[model samples]
Target: MKKHIFLFAIVCITQFIYSQNDNIPEKKTQKGFGKIDFLSIKMPETTIPNESNMGFTGIHYNLMMNDWSYAGLGIYGAVTGERGGFFTLGINAGIKKYFTNNFYLDTGFHFGGGGGKSAPDGGGAFILPHFNLGYNFKDLSINSGWSYVNFFDGGEIKGHQLNVGLEIPLDFSYADYDVAENDYSFDGLQKSNWNVNSKKSSLMLHLNNLEIKGDDTNKNVQNFGRATIRLAGFEIASYLSKNWFTFVKFDGAYDGIKAGYMDVFLGGGYHLPFNKNRTNILAKFGVGAGGGGGVDSQGGFLIYPDISIEQKIFDAFFISVNKGYVMSPNSHFYTSSYGLGLKYYVERNGIISDENSFSEGIFKGIEVITKQDLYFNAKRDGEPTEDMHQISVQINFDLNKNLYIAGQTSFANFGNAGAYAEGIVGLGMQTNPFINDKTSFFAQVLGGAAGGGDISTGEGFIVKPSAGFNYQLNNTLSLRTAAGYVKAKGGDLSSPFINLGIKYNLSFLKMN
Candidate 1:
């Protein structure tokens, strides 16, 4: 059995590689550019216009790992309005080679298949290769490509695509290129890409209304009159160029008739200047993920594309009006935000480089966290379950500054009509429980397997969601309190839980 398994694993890996670049040449060429991150959008069926119903959209993060090689991670999807579901997303790994200046060849593969309607053979056995040829000029690129998805039952999806992409410059050095001959101005950058000589950081406070909308044609799923608030948000960002900037934002909003909610998002955009920098028109595009509006604590994937106009009235103060949509994938709807706000800028010769800010982040905000807790089950089979001590640990990953993704597992008393153990994954949102920056709050929505206990019904599934608060008393310790609900298969909603435990804020040692 071991021999058979090992052989099978080898075969699968071989197949995965072959599907990626079997026909591409292995020739070497001039190393062109350094590492960078880029986002690309593909127009499917570009070659054969008749197949336009299925389109492609994607965002990719890539880096130059070596002199001759490039590595990338891509999150993309396939769909068309009134047709295929947009949720058929794909995560891809790819490699590229820059044979010469601004020209490249690439190939990528996605093992997670199933793009559209069901077929006799599950797309699980499908692996695809998307190949492309592209040319780069400054921070932008255009490409032509083709992708082939092959399923085991002889079913396939093939498409030719045209794409436009933008690269986030990672290096600021002006001496890397032959500017005199290439006309690169500085390090292959166009004149517009140069950073402003008088550098400054700004804060934008915005309040907007969130109007939600979506429809499910398959089952007639409809939602309406659901409104959320942008209440207010602060964007802490810096200018990359006179025309471009990136922002990290924190916000507080009302979740459609609820108390309040929070979110964090990272975005970038351009400023169309007017009147010699006194007034500017702006546009921003980016993606975010957040949660924590209701009892479920479920997180939502967000796409924020907005436009605004800013007018400088005082030496350091400004005003603006913004409008945009907070597109959510899981919710299948968008929250439209439009309102007015104020902005203030502080000029500094250089960016902040103090260790104090980093320290404050540890005390006030953490990018990733691990939590452990002990709790009791409220009831089981319509009866209050007894001292049901449970141990659960969860890893929470921040999607944006305000939202996160959580994966967790719990061990419980399985013999008493409650499950023994379960593993779950969900979306969530959190706040800095700011009792002098010593506390925090969070919520999540999780669903996964719930079974294996002696008294559990064969093997059942469960949706376990929660909301919690944490207070820190020391560097290594904190106190936790949480309330959660577990709705098992067969309408079992009797297992609500409350827990208290000591939390350990894990940290790593960094070298100076």
Candidate 2:
């Protein structure tokens, strides 16, 4: 397995190099739009053993690759029945056929990794395939479909059901990375239809210490006396105004509890600048659902409210300190937290009040990729090691010609441990195009949190080093493959993994 992994890394580099040559394939800058789907599905049976009949709430963002097809990300959570905290998130792609301007048939499938609330998610793998008929209106589309939900590992949950959805239009802007790199004018960006308030955005990393409050009477786990839970995660925020912004955060446990404790939050905030625009005060609030690790938050509804102070430490970089409280109103968990963070501004292509003004993400290249991972000899503390499958998304930002920074999140989709997840960030280096611009290769090292699904990821701290090949499909898309090893800190988890992915190149720039 180790030798194969090493060979795979070499092949990845070879493919990536060949894919980037000037002679391979060329395409012009293109414009595309996407849609967001708010949907629901209900199983056909009752709760528990009859885990059928449970209703799930879902959301998907599909980016149009063309008029009739899209690739996107989706998430679903149990809203009705006894499994309130059961959820899954992963990658999806779909195709639509239009019989008329207003009528269409939609088909798609979602592969996600997440399980909670003692739900029978054998190792956290979930699959849903749907077929629907719809009528499109000027503003939105409505559809109903037949869906098949399968948790394909050691899980016993399977169902056929009817699903309904609402589709709303979303718009964004992009340009070819290679084109923009050679001739950036920052004009014509206004020509694309954008829907956001501004192009300004920030990526933040945070380390937090939480003091557990409340009793275990309402939670899935019991008897904790003022424990301290340490967590780390990342946040991505986009400004709606100069002082207002919306954000999403994901955090995982590293201490004070068994590994696998995690949460994801969405909210908005306001920033007040002072000290000659170098210092600011910010207030934020987030609400979301979470449960896992032995410290189960039954019914899984949580809220976080906080205030912080930020100071600009360098150009495009800021440092912050915050104090906050966390509570699960519907469950039995509460905590007070103190945190420190580092934030970097990134320019995005979006709607701006002043078209001529620049946002922070000026001259950069970005890559967003969706991946499917297969891990060999995956293990649980007391069980035999087995193979596991996971779904993940990785975002990369070019720091220089041969180097890039990357962040990734992954969830187990087909393994013995359901509700298993991971989040990591690190740096990578790529070789120049080889094999006639058809392929290239690269390698990276990442460190972050992992735990859940009974995996022995001690304290949820881990490091992964990987190497891969990139096969350029076109100017803006590529096929990627990587092989890596994951080793947990102070834990008993070690595995070799391979992943296959689709990559999309994004350039947040304009040409003359």
1-512 in candidate 1: lDDT tens per residue? 99999999999987755643342211122223322222222324323344334344444444454554444333333323221222122234567668889898876665432222221212223455667787778676665566654433233343343443445434211211101111111211111223123344576656656665545441212323544543454565678766689876544442232322334456899878778678888898866543222312222346678898889998657898888876655545456677787787644322123311211111011222323333344334444444343345554544355576565544332223222344456788877448786778988897754332221212235677889887877654577778887665553334667777655443211111
Candidate 1: where is the Cα deviation over 4 Å?
Answer: 1-52, 78-81, 88-91, 113-126, 151-239, 246-335, 338-512
Error of 1 at 125 (Å): 7.3
Which candidate number maximizes TM-score?
2
TM-score (C-alpha, index-matched) for candidate 1 = 0.38
TM-score of every candidate relative to the true structure: 0.38, 0.82
lDDT of 2 by residue, 1-512 (tens): 99999999999977655443322212233423333333344433434455434556665677777889877887665544555456677777788889999999999888788776666778787688889999989678888879888887767778787788888676665656554333322232333343234467788988988787665564433555677888888888878778899888878777777777777777899989888768889899987755566664545557889999989999768998999987777436677878999998754554354423542223357888888999888767877778888888888888766799888888888767777788888899988778978688999998888887777888889999999999988877899999999999888788899999999886664211
By lDDT, the best candidate is: 2
lDDT of each: 0.47, 0.73
